[model samples]
Target: VQDPKHAKKTARNQLHSGARLLVLGNNVMLYRHLLTLAQAKNHAIYIRDVVNVDKQDDGAAYRLFHSDVLEQMYQNELENNEMQSLFVYLFVLGDLFDSYLNRNIFHKERIIMAMRGYFFLNMWAEYIES
Candidate 1:
């Protein structure tokens, strides 16, 4: 298993240097650890699936290796980061939000913002009650 601290250090150093990282492996633990660290640091990472031609040709079905926990964590981190970007685009770019709305792409953002707002309100309520 890759050390979590080492993975974090590598990811941070790479991002700081504006370099792309390509980790070629099927180690679920390593991927999860790196992704968790990336989420904590508000860093953006993209995952591209690489299909195995050998497996396909061998008549062996291609199956996803990641567990549900890993997939959920990845999706949550991605949506959270996208939500942050949505605000930045709306405030900083000025015209980008209008363009998204014109293309009907704002509906997804509307749902994400509503869900996030609800989550924060629940957290605040719990804090106040406690």
Candidate 2:
């Protein structure tokens, strides 16, 4: 507790502040807005399922949740942000480039690097996977 250098090294080594998916206790967070949205769409999107890997296997493997679930979560988070700038990186903006609406606009050539956004995505995966 008294060692600053060791504390700094530990901080650097840590995976950092985290989000929880409490499968062991079956306590998961369902956002209220997402619940409303799912109800409106007439679909309940459950994130996890128990599936047996093989007939010989004694137990089930918990497959990762569908990409759509993560995408929905990402989209919801991005939408909730005050700036909404994350969409340009998260969602494929390729369609916007082909639209006639964008025909007259000047687009920058590689104005931003995608690695930063990807780093966040990888970091989130670490939170989920680890």
lDDT tens digits by residue: candidate 2, 1-130: 3442332223212211134322211223233433333443332242212121132221111111223433554655445642133233213222221221234444442323234434554665576677
Kindly give the number of clashing pairs for every candidate. 0, 0
Candidate topping TM-score: 2
Tell me the tens digit of each residue's lDDT in model 1 across 41-111.
43333222112123222111111211332344455643544333222212222222222233554777656
- Steric clash count of candidate 2: 0
In candidate 1, stretches whose alpha carbon ends up further than 4 angstroms from where it belongs are 1-105
The segments of candidate 2 whose C-alpha lies over 4 angstroms from its true place after superposition are 1-32, 37-113
lDDT of 1: 0.33
- Of candidate 1, the 10-residue stretch with the lowest lDDT total is 57-66
Clashing pairs in 2: none
